[model samples]
Target chain A: MSTYRVVPAGSVFDRFAKHIFILPGLGVLVALVIYPTYYLIRLALSNFDLTFMTKPVFIGLGNFIQILSDTYFWGALGNTLVMASIAVALEFVFGLGMALLLNEDLRGGRIIKSLLIVPMMIPPVVVGLNFKLIFDQFGPLNDLLQRLGVSCVDWLGNPLMAKVSVILADVWQWSSFMFIIFLAGLQAIPQYLYDSAKVDGASGWRTFRFITWPMLVPSATVALTFRVMDALKIFDVVYMVTSGGPSFSTEVLSLYIYRTGFRFGTLGYASAVAVIMLILLTAIIEVIIKETRLGKRLEWE
Target chain B: MKVKSKYVKHCLHYMLICSALVFYLFPIYWLIITSLKFPGDVTASPVVWFTTKLTLDNYRLLFGHTGALWGAKQYVGRSFLPSIAPYITNSIMIGVLSSGFGLLLGALLAYGIVRFRIGGSRLYNWLLSLRMIPPVVVAIPMFTVFRTLGLIDTWWAVASAHLLMSIPFSTLLLIGFFSDIPGDIMEAALLDGCTNLGAFSRVVLPLAAPGLVAVFIIAFLTSWNELLIANVLTTTAKAQTFPVYTTSFAQVERGTAWGPAAAGGVIGMVPMLISSFYIQRYLVRGLTMGAVKE
Candidate 1:
């Protein structure tokens, strides 16, 4: 029998060597995450009976209930869901459309394809700043709308328009991502698909329904799941554009947590909000990825 | 009959393409027109207003100068060229260093995990779960940690913070890339008397070059455009990135300057556009990994 055994007799020595490479990253994760996360939970759950900073009275789940019932929290959640659903849904449709379009045999198509991706490259803050300026009453959008004799609606002031503005801005930036993925998916679809569909005399819409939709579902699922997850956590534009203002009409869950924790010095309450949001975002993302064929299928046309 | 059907499909396809173009192109046109006009015309004229003086003032202010918006003048200097120079340098340095170092680390960690099977497959998957938490959730906790580490207000601090997100991304990308390489080649290399590391560096790395470039560009963009944790971690101009520098254009007292901010926005698009021009093939290949593996 070989003297060099699997466990190597010295178990600790073997284990340590086995994972020598994993250490540096794991160590950093500990420093950056584990300790602070511990402190965050501690700060949230422990009651400072003596002083805000002082020693311990344990009040379990008090903060959780407080936040759960809080009107502001509910309002933020509602706003967040609306934006996420609208944004994700629209991006899916637009992305699918672009993907299909780019699939066509067009001339100099590559140049336009490249131009389409430029919006996604700009920084989010610059995006927010640019859109904010553009949405202003005197901004070009209003200027053009007025020239056409249409009413110049307040793009960022009204609650519905604010949500629409933020969602539209996001769609502009990320539709390209959706486009890119769908293009890849469409190409992967064996060309025999069309040849056979043609043999059967299926109409364009019918071929798409039978071939494209079924095959493209996985990519569509991915694009939808990704955008939905990301949209839940929107903060930047809502912050710079409206500051979730005109009396909190635009506030989302992430923005609310920021205001409560950093702005209001309610660290304990804010931590509770953060924990809830973390759980919610992960759970929703998991459900979407699982329920849809996104994670399970490689049928992929 | 088939040819006639194809003709109709082409017509429908062109219509769909036009609508998509209209949706994508309109906002960019709006952005350009707004940036060109003077501040006075911005509010006074209804949509599609023209600038009496179509000035490059916004671009000039972003490059350097003040009162155009983001007020680089008071801090960087009065000069138009050097005022925004520090922010430009910092953005470039931080973006390049973090991306370069991240690719190196991602390669090593990916190799260790994939080849050695150092931990369970579940553990590898769990490592990727870290990114799903979203940056906003982790921002405060990281801010506290970076503060404690005395990493606040340095390029290293921002870069390290970026690693929290990028490492997972690059590592997962690598896993997919590695999985695409034929196992038989690796085994053959081993039989040919090459050590594990030797085969990895020689065979696996080259095969995955397209993937590496794609992941590197993606990683570079992630760090370059990140602003949330960046806003808190870096206090001064020396540490601030491009996004933060552009924020200085939001001056309320003088009313926000569109020109400089828009100019800065346009400048920020350079790295991404220029990158796409050359490495376009590598990018799509990188993004569509495992999706098309033979």
Candidate 2:
């Protein structure tokens, strides 16, 4: 048997060894992230518009107040919330279904699973552009629609349809992510439970509900957490496809922030928006962690 | 009857799998076909599914290649607004270097935390949290910081931004790998006249190589796919990454040249697709372990 022990408390040199090993990584993080985060908060409180000012003027909560009053900000927030929730919900359901299907003793299951992940691995920008081409007015999708005897619809031009287009593209790319996570969870379920359930004459649905679903909750929670974060911060796809156009209808929070900071040269206001997003995400994640007990599951050594 | 129903279920399962395969493969197939289509064929209404006339004009234009082998398409060289070679090279550099540095820093951090208990579990959580922080938030401040350091439009700046996400992820993942290494082996090595560094280099490193490679691949993919930081931080051709370069093809002002844009998309996607297939097994472990084991 092998004994496991922490490096024993020892001389100054030993203690220094640990610190020395850790410093390079932690130092880079502090200089890059911690320091900038502090500066971000400061910028949020100031008037740092590059268009008019050479230096940021401390304006306290001026930028936040401006953001609160701006209907565009509210619209972007609403769009982000809608996009994230809808996309994540759809991804979960479809991914769960796919995972269950793939778990069946079907020939070529491995290949199918591997092929499914291709969409998620492709660059998000390409995903947006790929969907853009597909959703073009004279593109294949609309052509298919016309052939199906349905009137051609403006996939990326109409506001409601544009939002749907973005969401569908997102779901297409990310459902595989959810599938992979769910498949792992499904595989990890002990077979004896299913065997006993079968012996008791339970239906497939019943077996899944009673045995599989509960066991897969941890992975589901994990998947949901990742999808929610990614969806909330969606930028590349929206920016590529629509650029938040059709009268600012599809402008997501991140896209809005990017435009404000980089396009409009309003760094201070953008920083405020960014800060608010961070806080909002943190609060939402905290609630999720509490509800799912996900934090408790971390075996962070 | 039950057996018949089970056969039906299997058929349905296979049907679903085929649908998924089509759904995933269609866009990629379309990108290839569209890239090969001539400019006029690309824009034809009722969307040309199969092009009667194929041309390498788009690829030639995008690459600024005037090779005689391409014949007439070679004559259309330098017509494309910008060549994609610089962007591709920049992305490759950023991906390779960031993943490289990220693995080094992450391994060191993971080893310290796992072996010596550097900052407890809280530090681990903090690192994971950094990955979740919206890149836009960091980009706002870091933009100015990079501007000050004269690092804007530089590969190092882009790589540094990518390191933000990759280092934390690589560390979290490597911590998992390092923790699995039997402590007794390290102790045995220590007793056999090996220093801590010597044990890591001689034993732990060799054992952890596979995991390290997996971490590097994941880091590379993450950096490769990243767009927001690269877009914000790099203002010039020198550091404009592939994703950013691809987006230029679809810029709203330009009316989207579909054939060439599709070519760019295919160019950007091929490496990722190939590499993702190679690392498919490790993908689940990397994603789930990082998420669940935290």
Candidate 3:
């Protein structure tokens, strides 16, 4: 066998090589990210509407003050929180149930997993449009309801139902995401732990609570964090289905921002709303990461 | 009694799994059937679950073959309903270019961090935070910058914005992959007179090929499926991606063209549906940004 040789630590290549690999990519990203953040803050503190024939006039705390009293802003924020909490909660429950069921010794499990992936893989626009059809007045869902001797519900026309419809569409697409993550978490637990639990005469519930739940916390935190972040940014589905309709009952933050900036041409005010959203999301995520110790669990150390 | 209970439980398990499958798949099925139905039959009161009178008129309209359709008179002046071909091309070009560039930069960055411990844990936290920034926040300011630069309605504009998404994601994923590569292999390559860059390109890259492909496909899908950034940056079919094109069907004054929209949705979803199957093994890692290793 040939003896192994070691490269010298003080080689010519070693001194400057890391910088070459790291700087270009990092520099491009930081520059791109930083400029927009700077511009966003500047835009937030000004009056920049496309309708007016004037440059952006800097007005300190003006947009923020306006937001404080704007009913629409509060309504949109409320709607966003409501939709995200309900949708993510439902997704988590259904996803956990499905993951538990799937972890059993069932035949054709592989095929089922592949099929489960189809929903989350489809584009959100497509999912939104498809759900819109299903929830339409004369669509399949209403027809099925009528056959069962129930009056057809105006799914998108009513404020509450429109919110429910939007949430349903989101749950349908994203429950699979939680399912996939939780399933991975479940599988990662060693089989011997379950066997030992069984030897101690522990029931299924106890086995899960004592052994599985604690082991799955890291995965749950990751999955929940990702889903919560996504749920907060809900736009395509709401835009396609309701356009935040029925008197803005389902107007999420992202849709609100889009309409304000693009439709109403209030770039400055929209930027202010967007800045608030960013800070709120960052704060929520920081709490999650800290409380769950997800940063450490993620091997970031 | 015990054996009977076990059998009952197994049956219950099968039933649950079957129903779950139906729940997940029914919407996709509904999309396809609706796309194939005649315009009148599409909204029939009883809901035409299946029809032998299936027609490709929706597809024809979406493809801009309206000149030959029987009711061509109705679509005469509707200039907004253009062929989806150009938008599809735009999406393909943008997805490929953005993800391709993202993979290059992200892979290099990931290698440096994993191998040399370039930035440490603080950098990792920063990258994760970047991933969490909502798209609307970025889109707002980028719109003004792009408009000023006259880059609005160009593929590069959308592609560059998508790079904001793809780079952090791909880097995070590649960091996981690069960490998995054995250090001894790289050392051996260096001992054999391979330069640092040479070892990465020739040895580390080949070993991590699967992970790279996985990252590229995911990044491609992210850019491809993205709507907000693409919508803000593109005003017309010149650089509009497929999702933007699909959303054009929703005209407020005149009711939405459901049939054609369904067809557009189908066409937009086909590539991803196919890719979903191809990348099944990597789905967990890719979706979770390597938080969950398969």
Best by lDDT: 3
lDDT pick, better of 1 and 3: 3
DockQ of each: 0.36, 0.60, 0.70
The residue ranges of model 3 lying beyond 4 angstroms of the native Cα positions read A1-14, A298-300, B70-80, B252-256
* Candidate 3 or 2, higher TM-score: 3
The CAPRI-style docking tier of model 1 reads acceptable
Could you tell me the lDDT of residue A210 within candidate 1? 97
Candidate 1, residue A140: Cα displacement in angstroms equals 2.0
Q: Rank the candidates by DockQ, best first.
A: 3, 2, 1
True lDDT of residue B82, candidate 3: 84
Ranking by lDDT: 3, 2, 1
Clashing pairs in 2: none
Segments of candidate 1 deviating more than 4 angstroms: A1-18, A46-59, A292-301, B1-12, B32-55, B65-82, B118-121, B250-255, B282-294
> Which residue pairs collide in model 3, if any?
none
Q: How do the residues B1-294 of candidate 3 rate in per-residue lDDT, one tens digit apiece?
A: 999999998899889988998888888888888888876777776788888878787788877774655355676424557888999999999999999999999999998888777677677778888878888999999999998899999999999999988888989899888888887887788888776788899999999998898889889998989999999999988999999987866543322577778899999888787778668888888887777787
lDDT for residue B83 in candidate 2, whole number 0-100? 84
Question: What are the lDDT scores of the predictions, listed in order?
Answer: 0.70, 0.83, 0.87
